[model samples]
Target: MRKTDLLAALALSAAAVLPAAAADEVNVYSYRQPELIDPLFEAFTEKTGIKVNSVFLNKGMVERLKAEGRRSPADLVFTVDIGRLNELVEADVVQPVRSATLEANIPAAFRDPEGRWFALTARARVAYASKERVKDGEITTYEDFASDKWRGRICTRSGAHPYNLALTAAMIAHHGEQATEEWLRGVKANLARKPQGNDRAQVKAVWAGECDVAIGNTYYMAKMLADPEQREWAESVRIVFPTFENGGAHMNVSGVAMTRSAPNRENALKLMEFLVSDEAQRLYAELNAEYPVKPGVPPSELIRSWGEFTPDDLPLVEIARNRPAALKLVEKVDFDG
Candidate 1:
């Protein structure tokens, strides 16, 4: 062949490669707020040249995934809360991904045995109390939330919220139905006001002197320090990991799973593996302010500053399994108060 003919053939081959390169993009459905996750998305794309197209929502992703079904354009699901992840698995919207890298990065406690979903970060339902009003050694466990000293002085988000509901489920897992009911009754009697708002609001209530003790995830305290207006809300309160006295602090997860009908299965697995990789794990910590599920990955300096403690190793799937019973118990105990 002539030199000119060879050059023309090479140019045709390059043209054929362009579309596949462009198709490297992955579509994602995320329950995380965009502002919280977009930076990481940008970073992933920068590193791998795989563009990310995502839909962000605060509610109803499982139903949406069901509606989308096999025809779903979404290739991945990213969500908060083990209950939601389990719901996706039970609904058959997410399929198991057998990625050795993900299995290696995430601890057994943070992932489904079937690999349907894997947690990227962890958050604890901890106690926050007045820096001056509640002495350091005065409270050390979730059981302490029920004591009469905190009665009429505790604040919290609605028990119906997934975070609280999951924590309630953890209680059921550890103490049995009867004991959990009594504990809820005690916590209800102690409410400073009706359960309302997000975790940050609970800290605000403590700062305003509306309450002395509140329940919130450890990360919300970091959120407070990051937001100028809310930094002081966290000021008057110190985070206390409720080590359960008998077990460990109740924990929840933010995790990801592949769509049941992912069109780009190989790329989906790649993304999942990348997410659990050391570099991505560090980015997850910096951007999200939650503890990394990858055992050796350090969390944001803020999270580390909050101090470290043992996490309750309860199979998180159990919390998801008992969510319905937990919600029922919450109603029975009138935790809505």
Candidate 2:
């Protein structure tokens, strides 16, 4: 079925399960998987007596919200990646939220200047180095991936993927366009094979002796370790927190935004505030194996085991702004081909 059709069916199913006009309820259009977020919703409902209804969309969330216009049932939109949040802001479908609780809980670096969006959790773009083939301290920075020593020894997903694009954008933020392009060319030259598969697949390649290092997110290690089939792959590589020359490790986020056509604005605000609470932050960190955006809240023990590094201070807005240039460079370099 088409993505829109599937979204419509899921919306209808959600409506059937929960009252359409419930007096105390909030609706969400989320890109996050239900299993990853339902527990938080349940906790919110239990604590506040507010019903939470959600529709999961794999793609086309901004288009769907645009189509619904003022009648859209969505109160909040949940998604990962700054590029996606910027899309909602650019579409003018989300409104600015002024909440003291949010400002105090989330750091200034992780939120929008105009209060249009707030990040909930953070993940780093890191390397999964083969335990046997890669020695400790051999890889310490993202720039090392482009070194001649790594030629034919690295693996990654498609350059066009949002995750890779964000990383590329960060490169541009650190080094100007020409230098970033050169860096891209160098990294492309090091690929063991054509850029293919998701982040986990890169790690699997390392396990299969296809490459010495795989570029991926930190949470995937926990996820792979949890799955019995991929446990061997998880065990074969160790997470490496590479930095940007003088800066720290590169970080990305999963964030939330309040929609403009919020029918239950009050309830939505309540949920938004609740999501950043210490309790909720802890739940999110433990459940998703992510680093919570809230200060004083710790990540799950499993996540902490991967070790820690200072996060890059480069603002996410800069990364989002550089996305167009990043894509153009990717195409120019033909990183995927």
Candidate 3:
């Protein structure tokens, strides 16, 4: 279906499930799947007595909001990836939030300096190495993906994918464009096959013996382990938190922003503050298998079992700014070809 039509259908589905508008309620336009966020919303409503209405859009959230202008029903926006969050800021669809609660709960590295967006959870871009073929420390840094040692033994999704692009942007932030381009070419030369499928698919390739190591997010390990059909694939690989030469693991976030045209401004601010609370952070960590952006909140036991590593201190906005250059390098390398 066309993107517009698909968004409309998703809106209708959300409307059909939501109750009639309540006197005290907040509306959300989310790129996150409903199942992943509904529990948190339910808990918020139960505690605060403010209803939460959400429309799950697969894409075009900024466009929809721009089109809706001052009449938009959305009070908040939620999405994965710094790139998407940056798009909201760039389009001026979201306004700055100045919640002391949010600033206190979240670290400086994970939030917008201007308070335009705040990360709810974090996930590292890690390596999934074959337990049988790759040693515990065989893959140490993301730079290792381009080493001659792993040629024809690496698997990843399209380099242009937001997840990969974010990583690429980070490389640029650290190594400069020309060097990052060289690194991209080297990594591309190492691909086991044409870039295909999701992060899970890359791990499945390792399980199938098509590759020795794959690039993917840390959360996928937990997700695969929970799925009955994909358990073997999860078991076949060990999670490796690779870092830059002198930096820590590469991390990305799923974040929230307040809409500029928030109709329920007061309730929306309340929800925003609530999302950073210990209860909400725990729910996010446990339910989604993500690292809580709020310090002092523990991740799920399953995620903890994978081990931990320091996250790179590079500001996410820098990553977002470097994205266009990263995409150009991906095209210049023809990474998926």
Best by lDDT: 2
> Which candidate number would show the highest TM-score if scored against the true structure?
2
How many residue pairs clash in each candidate at the backbone level? 0, 0, 0
* Prediction 3 TM-score vs. true: 0.94
Q: State the lDDT at 107 in candidate 1.
A: 86
Per-residue CA lDDT of model 3 for 120-176, tens digit only, reads 999999999999999866788888788999889999999999999999999999999
TM-score of 2: 0.95
**Candidates sorted by TM-score, descending order?**
2, 3, 1
Sorted by lDDT (best first), the order is 2, 3, 1
Model with the higher lDDT, candidate 1 or 3: 3
lDDT, candidate 2, 34-151, per-residue tens: 9999999999999999989988888888887776667678889999999999999999999999999999999988999899999999999999999999999999999878999999
Each model's TM-score, in the order given? 0.91, 0.95, 0.94
Superior by TM-score: candidate 2 or candidate 3: 2
Q: Where does candidate 2 clash, by residue pair?
A: none
Candidate 1: tens digits of C-alpha lDDT, residues 1-337: 9755654554343234322223588777799988877877887888888887777757766666665556666778899999888889988999887877887888888999999999988888888989978887888888778889888999999988899999988888888899989999999999989999998898899999899988898888877887899988888888888887689989998999998867767767778888888888888877778888897878887788877789999989889988999999998877885
List the candidate 3 regions with Cα displacement exceeding 4 Å.
1-22
Give the local distance difference test score of model 1: 0.83
